[model samples]
Target: MSTSGRSRAAGPDETPAIGRPRDANRDVAILDATLLLLTEVGYDQLSMESIAARAGVAKTTIYRRYRDKVALVAAAVEYRSQSSPPAVGPGGLRGNLLTLVQWLAEQIAEQEIGLLGALFAGMRSDPGLAAEMRRILRRDEAAMTDQPLREAVKRGERLAPHAAELFAEVAPAVIVHRIVVAGETCDERFVEHLVDDILLPLLRGHPNKPARTERGTGSKGTRS
Candidate 1:
């Protein structure tokens, strides 16, 4: 709700003007309404009229800012991301990763399953919406991984060459799979296991065993 000092993704025609400044309150109202509707209904069912009604603003007011539904939804997604950024806690890589994954798990768990399903459906059906969401998600994922990895470097930790990319892939995939796909609880124990057992070994490039070479073909392989 508090958008002070936060930079939002620009609306379609949201250029600066010399006229009376746009009301920040109205922007907040509109964005909040959009997210609420997204959770309640979905991208396919959501409309400018519904958002306008929920926000208590004219339909024209919504269109005047955003070019279309995709643009509006994209802006809303960006706003939500900017509003609730990842909370990087104090400590080294392990501590920070645990904190980050726990936060991510909590956020994912808070979302309604229906909303998640709707988003998945929408993304599959709508190219424009999928593209917009992907762009926003990639940026967020980078932000989530960059800080902890940078700090780990400062601590003289020997990380794998692609540590950030690896973390970005492994942690979220496991968490989302546990909650959304497997319908399992992503509790504290699970988070700690993910960080200690899987992620830490991976980032530090600690292989479980040395590669074994086949005698005939001379092909090397490691156990999964």
Candidate 2:
């Protein structure tokens, strides 16, 4: 959940400028500063000056790299969410989903929930930030769900149409709703319940309603 210290190279849209290359050190510093400030003050209170002061760089330096705070904040969020692919379990779909849910729970734990809620609050007012959030989340959701389903298919399992979309929504929707609306943290147990009781059964195309299993029975639920 930590942001990488190595700065990314200029993106596709970056204009070719006839000058010294952008300083990688400054880029990391700026991003690091932005993340820290986000946790401290939330999104609305953040500004270019405060970020520059915290990062020990000039405001113009930040502007040269990012057009505005929305883009900068988006970049910071993307950086925070960077992680290796979720580990697939040997139990096929069920195992893979358990790993995926736990991984997401860990990521969510690292984030300051209030800070995230603040960002969500700004989504309506700032179309650019909202679009960026959607883009990143969609790309991430695809990666998270697609690989597991493909592996399951390889193992001779059947999958439902729209399964990927359905499974992808479960973790994020539940996690965010828990944090933002329900005012609860999604502990490991809740995440296990979500995967085993809800998501796994849905992907299996069972028509019967799910029954509540014993508290520690999630692992059992995955066993064939």
lDDT for each of the candidates?
Answer: 0.73, 0.72
lDDT of 2 by residue, 1-224 (tens): 22222225332234677678777888788888987897788777889999999999999888887888888887777666667556567766766877887777667667776667767876766888788778766677777777899899899877767888887666677776776677777765677678767886677675254524433453444321
On residues 145-208, what C-alpha lDDT tens digit does candidate 1 reach at each position? 8888888888898988898888877877887889878888987667767776678888889745
lDDT of 1: 0.73
For residue 213, model 1's alpha carbon misses the true position, in angstroms, by: 28
What's model 2's overall lDDT?
0.72
Clash numbers, per candidate: 0, 0
- Each prediction's TM-score versus the true structure: 0.77, 0.78
